[model samples]
Target chain A: MNRSTGFAFIAPLLVLMVVAFNLPIIYMLGLAFWDKGRGFTLEHYEGLLEAPVYLRVLGNTLRISLIATIANVAIGYPLAHWMRGLGRRARLIAIALVVLPFWVSILVRTYAWIVVLGNGGLVNRSLQWLGLTDAPVQFLYNELGVTIGMANVLLPFLVLPLFAAMIRIDDRLLQAAASLGAPPRTIFWKVYFPLTLPALAAGTLLVFILCLGFYVTPAVLGGGRVPMISNLLDTLINQIPRWEQASAISTILLIVALVIFAGYRRLDRKASA
Target chain B: MTSTPWSRRLLAAAGIFGLVFLTVPLLIVIPMSFSPARALTFPPPGFSLRWYQALFGDPRWMEAMSTSTIVAVLSSVAALVLGSLAAYGLRRGSFAGRDWAEGNFMSPLIVPTIIVAIALYLSLAKVGLLGSFVGLVAAHTVLNVPLVMMVMGVAVRDFDLRIEQVAWSLGASWSYTVIKVMLPNLAPSVFAAWIFAFIGSFDEVIVTSFIAGKYETVPKKMFNELILEVNPTITAVATLLIAVTVLALAAVTLVLGRAGKLGQTLVER
Candidate 1:
């Protein structure tokens, strides 16, 4: 194909991106710095630091995201490792089991948790049936519920990458460690764990970044009581329609995601090299 | 490596627990959908398809489903066209700033959907496109194009363009070469792209929530329903969505597995 023709073919996507993707983010970034009444200022960015509520929400966002990421890793790592140990057919089945939830809508999955963990819901009833507790536990509409829900929602994200990472890990390395007098636990901690760090890093970064932006799970599970950055950004834009504050939060989130993404890319390059 | 007895036990128990943790809630939704009871209860009292009937009967539910289907179809088709073009262009020959150009296209999947939500809202509303079908399709197309490119780009990478050149050398037009040679060769990835874009658009909620305005897709309708009250019909909707997902997954696996790229194909959506 000729140069112009090739460029012409690519032009539609470029034009659409300019209109839909690139311009909107630029506009949002402009809104962050552009004040309607004052024309232009760093007031919104300054306000993020000045206001305790914004700062608190920012802190809450980081804290909750960290917890969610940690939780996902705790759950996903062992599962990925186990799948790695299984036969090929069994591994595929295990993977299918893991990937199944990614098909479910985030809202639906979060809603399902409300059913599973709600007062007088399945977990509560099961507990009652077992005579473990006298009263129904308040699992939903709380941080624990939100954490569980978010972690669960992000599990596939974690496992898929971890599984892929582990798939690349040569068994010979483990054998090398074992033959060199490393015990099973030592082999895992030394050879297995170190080799999987790239995938571990990749999954952690993905899950953490995702958790940082996650809205539905935290919104539904938090029951409006807990606040994450995404929800806070939503409240600023939707309920209060505070465009400046919302833009600031969105910008902060964009920066955080980019930084971590860049960091992960660096790690990935090193791992691959 | 032979694991210690305690280690084996630990792995077995944790594996079982993880699988159950992953699947039990989904399984719970099935029975809840069939329950004759109104409330969200487990071990649902008696089985009935009342929710299914209700879902089918309700115009709002049906409208949402149809609207979602329309958006999903229209957006995916557009995304496939545009994304394939971009993928082909990128793969044709290396260019300066090619990485930068690719980054712009893939940014949607990485950037938070909420950011995309607000961005599309502001940009679309500015041009008098918000809440309209045009606006939603535009936004969804943006969201799904990267998915198409990722899937189709794999095919583009694998299939040598020399055949297309040869076809052109034989007097076949560029369009003709692409249509007759390239497409058939990359059919599996085309199917994969369509499936990803279709399902991605269908399952999209956050961006749609912001830009959808009056056009309520299924997820938006369900979100609204939750805001009012959790209804039995939602379980019905979820069940249907799950069923759709299963079929879609099966189809994708069948196609992409044949291509030996199922692992890469599975993660995008």
Candidate 2:
């Protein structure tokens, strides 16, 4: 296609980006610098730095996201490897099942967890049923619930990339290794594992970034108790109506996401090279 | 593919068990929604259509459903048009900064939703668009465009443009060539993109919670209720949504399966 027409085709998307994606962010960046109470000032940033609550929330957000990301990667790798070993039909079934939760609404998924982990819900009842405990478990509305729900929602993000990497693996390499008297475990460690690193790295980055920004899962499952950055920002923007502090928090989140994204690209290039 | 020894067997067992872990919670919600009891208990005492009946009996649930459908429908359409054109350009059109352009388009997915939400909320407030249906639709459209673009770009790339060139040589206009020759081949992919966009818009809560206020989308309303009261009604909604999701996924999978590029086709495409 000619340059003019090609540019024309891309124009609508660029317009969309400018209006919806880029412009809002630019607007928010401006809001971050402005004080909601008075004229333009650095008070928002100062408050963010000085306030112990904001610092604690930021720490909690990072800790929770990190934990969830690690758990997802750990679980996703083994599952992806296992699925890769299955026959075509079984692999498809396995993947579809793994991804089934992806189709559920975020709200619904969190709600499902509430029912599963609530005081009067399944886990508590099951524990009692099995006579393992007399009392119901304190599962929901805590850090533990937040971690489980977030990890569950984001598992597919890890699995898809890891599974994709596994499929790209050449069977010949494994066969050659085996023929060279390498045991299955040895071949997996030396051959398959290294080859899958790029995807694992990619999946980890993707999940980490995603988990960091996850708001609803934490909010619903965290029960206003475990305040993540997103939840804090939500309160500022909605309840308190402090646009500047909210903007600052949001700006921090964006910066972290960008750093993670840049790291992902660097790792991806190294892996490919 | 030849199977391995014990490791393979172990991997298979682990994989199946993980699948059960992933799916059982969602599975439980379905039967729980059908239970005669109002409270959720595992191994549901008895199955009945009480919750389902309540869903239909209540006007608010129906209204929420309609509102969700409206938002999804409008956003998906906008995404389909804008995304396809952009994807077509980036794929077929040789241009400088094409990689940058594609990445820019998909950046919405990577950017923290809170950032997107805060920005949109502020921007909408400036333009007198806050709490407006149009604002919410616009946000969702922006959010969904990347997905549609990704899918359509794949479909367009795999498409043989030689046929379109031939049609053009036979005196067909560019639009006509695209419509008659290119579009039929692309119809399924386009439809799939539409479904994905629809699903994405419908299920979204984070961005919606920020953008949507008193003008409540179903998910947003459910979120409000969830924060205030943990009830079986949300379970009922979850059940209906899960059922729809299963059905929709089955349809999409069948289409992708028939296309013979089920897994990779979605991502790379």
Candidate 3:
């Protein structure tokens, strides 16, 4: 079989990707540099630095991502361990439970949180009924709600990789340690924990990068009062129609995410080495 | 050995708590959709089908659904063709720049979708493709083609080349060999790819906002409703979405569990 024939078959795909997929990204980077009105001004990039708002939002986005990553790790590690211990059928069911949310629309998942956390929602009614509070606690329209929502949406992401790593771990090692008189905690910390660090790193990298670019979750759950970088990008585009600024922020976002992801890749390589 | 009993119990409780945390909010939306008060309240004041009626009655929602379906169907088909073709081209042995192509092709999966959306918006606007139905299809194809490629890449790798060889030896034409021998083996994965691509396009809100000029996808409409207005009918729509999601995941699970186990077998090379 001629590999050239294979190239002929794939040429359309490569062309389509180069044109529609790759070109647009390169185009966006171009737009960031040369504005239509200003003829290649750094004003937009400068604005990002000069404006405290962008910096604050960037810092805050990083903070929230860290918090959510921590939450996911805390919840995901045990869930993965538990699923690893399950029988085959039970493990499949558990896998499905984790994947169902992944397959669902982000919009639908955010709506679900709204229903539960709304002022006239289950939590408020429960609090009121139990005489805990006379009023709704304002769960929605805040950072806490956004964190909870992000964690719920991202939990499966953390768990899946962790589960994969856990399942591949040899049980005999644990038994060996046990027979050698190592306690359960000691075995877990020394043997199991070190092995799963790679998965944890991968999951955190994914979830954190995703969190930084997240628009819908924070916007819907944050009630427009809280602004992440994406939320701020929306304002500049829709309300102010500042394409230059929008492009600038988006470019920064793209680069920051890529840089961090690249950094993680290097760290992962070094750690594995 | 599992663990100490105390640790085992603790992990089990955490596992249960995690599952509930992930699933309960999604389930709670079902009853809220039926709330007669047009607001989300616990133990809903009463149950009624008014929200569903409103959703079925609304032309705007219907239009959005129709648009999304048309866009999804068109893009998924396009993605399947383009992606599968690409997969068929690459053999197991590495080619020069295969690593670069592989990484770049899947870059769409990384690099924030918002960036993609914005970039596509700008480029399409330049060529006057903004908000055009064709633009939406093209943008969506870009989003889903990589997924299709990833899925079909596995199927192609696992495929028995000997079967394809027999067809060739029997003097089957190129198209006939592909249509008869190769495609049959690829059918399960093709279907799975189509569903994933369809769901991705259908549920896409961010990218649609950029190029879907004058068009409203169901998710984009739902976003507007979520942000600007509160409607009980949106709840009804969401419940229907949950039902669809259940069906979609079921199909995915079945396909993945079956023979070949395409996605389960291979990953990015």
Top candidate (TM-score): 1
Model 3 regions more than 4 Å off: A35-41, A130-134, A263-273, B92-95, B260-269
Cα lDDT listed for each candidate: 0.84, 0.84, 0.82
Deviation of model 1 at B24, angstroms: 1.6
CAPRI-style class, candidate 3? medium
Q: For residues A240-269, write the lDDT of model 1, one tens digit per residue.
A: 878877887788889989999888777766
With candidate 3 superimposed using the best TM-score fit, by how many Å does residue B77's alpha carbon deviate from the native?
0.6
Pairs with backbone N, CA or C atoms under 3 Å apart (clashes), candidate 3: B131-B213
Q: lDDT tens digits, residues B88-180, model 3?
A: 777543456766776676778788888888888878877888878887898889889878887888889878888888888999998998888
Name the weakest run of 10 consecutive residues (lDDT summed) in model 2 chain A: A264-273
* Each model's DockQ score: 0.65, 0.66, 0.67
lDDT of 3 by residue, A180-233 (tens): 999888888989888878877877787888898888899888888778988887
Superposed by TM-score, candidate 1 places the C-alpha of residue B41 at a distance from the truth, in angstroms, of 1.4
Error of 1 at A42 (Å): 0.7
Candidate 2 chain B weakest ten by summed lDDT: B260-269
| TM-score of structure candidate 1 | 0.96
**Looking at candidate 1, what is the lDDT of residue B135?**
88
lDDT of 2 at B213: 68
Candidate with more favorable, higher lDDT: 2 or 3: 2
